[model samples]
Target: MKNILLILIFTSMAWGETPHDGMHHTHEEHVHEKFVDGKKLEVDPERFDKFIMDLKDTQIAIVNVQGMVCDFCARGIEKIFKKDINVKKIDVDLSKGKVLIAYNVAHEIIFEDIRDKILMNGQNAIDMQVIDL
Candidate 1:
């Protein structure tokens, strides 16, 4: 019975399903289909594609940043912003040193909050502005 249970658990995990359904494991890695410049493009795998797809009506808050030189830095930014209840999604453009945040206006998040978050994460915040999407 023990061996059979172990096998079942492993099999479910292998198939990207956990014993607990539709919660923790739902954020498993997945690609996105996007059309850009009159051509179809596979979205960046490094991005938080699942969260972005769930955006309904959001505002884009662009934060000019610095000191993000690697994948880990981008991931840190992604994780930090995603923690905010108001932040629906985040895209960290490492090359441009910018973090694009999709936030719901109901929470009344401000640029200062984002700037402080960046400072806490050891990244420099250069500028921040918002645009309705």
Candidate 2:
């Protein structure tokens, strides 16, 4: 019985489904370290201007996110936003703690939906700005 129990526990861990605090472990529960020792990346004004220029016809949403400290966090945000059909382009800047989303001009910006998606990625969308270009 003891060997059987040990085998079951090892198998569950190998499958990435180990129990934690009475709940099944999930990717979101994994901890991530800060990028660059938590130093904010300096934004180059010229590059930012180019990014805006490239999405001339789209409506851009600048979402200020919290807890976006690493590349993993950025990728999670990118994955969530890419699922939205209205999103034309998505960029996650961990240095600025922002998610820049270029949406189709015909689609209206939905703050609530954006907030929800960020939450799903284990981040908080604290503020948002919209610009039509």
Best by TM-score: 2
Write model 1 residue lDDT over 1-133, tens digit each, in one string.
9999999998886532111111101111122333222322223434534435667666656567767788875676777777888877788777667677888856665666777777677777666645443
Query: Top model by lDDT, which number?
Result: 2
TM-scores, all models, native as reference? 0.56, 0.64
TM-score of 2: 0.64
Q: lDDT tens digits, residues 1-133, model 2? A: 9999999998887532121111111111111222233422234445446566667567767677777899965787888889999998887777788777888888978777888888787777776656566
List lDDT for all candidates, in order.
0.59, 0.66
User: Which segments of model 1 are wrong by more than 4 Å?
Assistant: 1-54
Task: Supply every candidate's count of residue pairs whose N, Cα or C atoms clash at under 3 angstroms.
Answer: 0, 0
lDDT for position 120 in model 2: 85
